[model samples]
Target: MLLVDHVTKIFDPGSISEKVALKNVDLFLNEGDFVTVIGGNGAGKSSLLNAIAGKFFINDGRILIDDIEITNMPEFKRAQWIGRVFQDPMMGTAGNMTIEENLSIAIRRGKNRTLNWGINRNEKSVFEKHLSELELGLEERMKTKVGLLSGGQRQALTLLMATIKKPRLLLLDEHTAALDPSTGKKVMEVTKKLIADGGLTVLMVTHNMKDALEFGNRTIMMQEGAIIADIPLEEKKTMKIENLIQLFEKKSHTPFANDRMLLN
Candidate 1:
């Protein structure tokens, strides 16, 4: 469903501080594939997602979603086919908008704005059903402003918003990183449910090795802006954190050194 071909992203091209965030990186995801990305600092995990989302145009290469070229498409235009949730819970939703209001915006993403601004009964019913599946009692508080929600609640809601329309590709950038362990786990559960229900194609970058291995059918390790390891489902099933670290050292010729990733 997604193809990233020989993509390279270089920041500050001719300057002394020039950094290549992506180095001819190539990746492909089949429809319904859920791939988890892992890497240390400067490994280009988030950079890959940003490139795909067109936060900035890449210096080289092509990106396609379900056969349509989107390499040079503007971010707003790409939103029609891509849905993303950021690391920061506060980044995804409007704080002042009520729960239903925020959902209404998400529901209308990439669509033409209509003259009628009211949420119809059918739309409200759909929102209630989806919120109820989160099991957070958000269905009962649809009138509450999103700003009043706790971090976990907001993140869960963000997850729902991102998937409400089932975009062609879903980009989850360390989505559960900011929540408490217990809350993060809950959000992950919701994430898994949403992905499974939609049969969505997903690329999730995460620092936690355990989550990376446990959650996805495939796990990829990146270093210095290149993908060093891509473990398929069968191989990933037998892999553990230690095995991943060993593989990283083997391929990158450097010890796994991200403390945040390790300690998590």
Candidate 2:
């Protein structure tokens, strides 16, 4: 389970530029829950994700994973239990490294390093098995440098690396936002397969309303640092983009004004 208890974050507190990014937000996710978050700019969607991931300290409240307190843990320390995929394809992987080398590091996350050669036949076979699931023929490019892969391929590989060890929580920060439409759909398919296969708990932030409704078990809408609406799978299945916009306006008591979100 994952918990965000009364969490709040403020930037430049008590100054003219002060901004409240999160406002005593409380969210709980059960095991294997896949929730998609949607919001306009400055709605604190990414702030919530960064807070849970320990990218920065929350000004108040606590964060816990499976009953263990991690509120004060450094980002690197928290990484053991958290797997993240960023929006930019280049941010998640080591471009200069070979695909196998990158996977090797991910598989060894939170483990002590040894002087032994990084890849053994057994590990290679495991890598091939995982890469084959992407069905992008990445297994054949194991020895190739990751920098040469296309944006979608690299994002797919990053997704694989993030869940290879079955992290307790996965944070996907608009991970498919950078891909072309077709490529993005392909990546989403792979994402669904992996989540089901691993029974992974995921929190995905997305701007695409169609994706928000289509992909996850539940959808949450944020506005000005608070979750104003949460629709479960049954409700979401029947909701269209127009209905979602109406619902957002009704819950937020304001017009939906984010042009980028509407355009997507």
Candidate 3:
């Protein structure tokens, strides 16, 4: 469902501060494939996703989603096929809007909007039903303003909003990094449930090694803007943490330096 070929991005080209964020990067994902990405700092993990999402134009190569070439497409035009969650919990939703109002916006993503009767009863019921599945009791507070919500609550809503329409590809950009362990785990559970229920394709970038191995069907480790290792489901099922650490060291020729990834 997704294909990236020899994609390259260089920042400040020809300058003393030039940085090659992505170098001949290539990756492919089949329909319903859930892949977790892991790497040390400066590994270009997020850059890969940004390139696919067309946040900025790449220097070379092509990107295709569901067989359509979108390498040159702008970010806004790609919104219908991609759902992205940033590291910041506050980035996804309108804080000042009520929970129901926020969901109404999400439901209408990529569709024309009008000021017709705001949030009908049927829509409210559907949103309530979906929120109840998170098991967070958000159903009781649909009328409450999102700004008044806790970080986890707002994040849960963000996840729901991102996937309400079953986006062709979902991007999770270290979304749980800002939350406490318990809350992060809850959000992950919601994420897994939602994806499984809809059979959505997902590419999630995470610095946490344990979460990276535990959640996705496949895992890809990158370093210096290149994919050093890509492990499939059968191999991943029996893969050990120690082995993974050693693999990264061998491939990158340097010890992993991310404490949150190594210690967690």
Candidate 4:
């Protein structure tokens, strides 16, 4: 459902400080495919996601979502087919809005707004049903302001909001990295459940090696702005952590330098 062909992204081109964030990067994802991305610092993992999300125009090549070229599509325009959650818990939702109000906005994503009642009982019921699935008791607090909730709670709500209407693709940019272990695990569980329930296509960037291997159907390793290894589910199932380290070292010709990834 997604294709990135020979894409390149350079910051400060033609200058001494030019940094190639993405170097002719090529990637593809099928419908319902959940891929986890792992990389050391400056490996273009987030850049890859950003390129797909249309955060900035690529220097060259093409990007397509479900066969439609979106390389030059504005980020807001691409929201019709894309849903993303950033690393910061505070990035996805309006903190001052009530939980239900926030959900109302998500429900209306990519749709024309009109003069009407804010949220009907049926919509509230649906939101409650979805919130209940998180098992975080948010269903009972729909009227509460999002800013008052804990970080993990807010992130979980953001995940729900992002997926309320199934977009063609979901981009998870280390959505769990800022949370504590147990809370992160909870959010991951919710993520898996929602993705599976909707058969969603997903690309998630994560620094935690164990989470990378455990969550997605495919795992990709990046280095120096390009993909170095792509491990399919069957291979990843048999792949040991030690073997993965060895593979990265062999492929990149350098030891993996992300201590947070290794320690996780």
Best by lDDT: 1
Measured over all alpha carbons after superposition, the RMSD of each candidate to the real structure, in angstroms, is: 0.9, 1.1, 1.1, 0.9
In model 4, which runs have C-alpha deviations exceeding 4 angstroms? none
Tell me the tens digit of each residue's lDDT in model 4 across 205-246.
998888888888999999999999999999989888778888
Q: List the candidate 3 regions with Cα displacement exceeding 4 Å.
A: 115-117
Cα error, residue 70 of model 4, in Å, equals 0.5
Per-residue alpha-carbon lDDT of model 2 for 151-245, expressed as tens digits? 99999999999999999999998999999999999999999999999999999999999899888899999999999998988998898999999
- Model 4, poorest ten-residue lDDT window? 255-264
lDDT of 4: 0.92
At residue 228, what lDDT does model 1 achieve? Answer: 94
How big is the positional error of residue 23 in model 3, measured in Å on the Cα after superposition?
Answer: 0.6
The TM-score that candidate 3 achieves is 0.97
Model 4 scores a TM of 0.98
Residue range with the least summed lDDT across 10 consecutive positions in model 2: 255-264
| Tens digits of lDDT, candidate 3, 19-119 | 99999988999999999999988889999999988899999899999899999999999999999898899999999999999999999998777656478
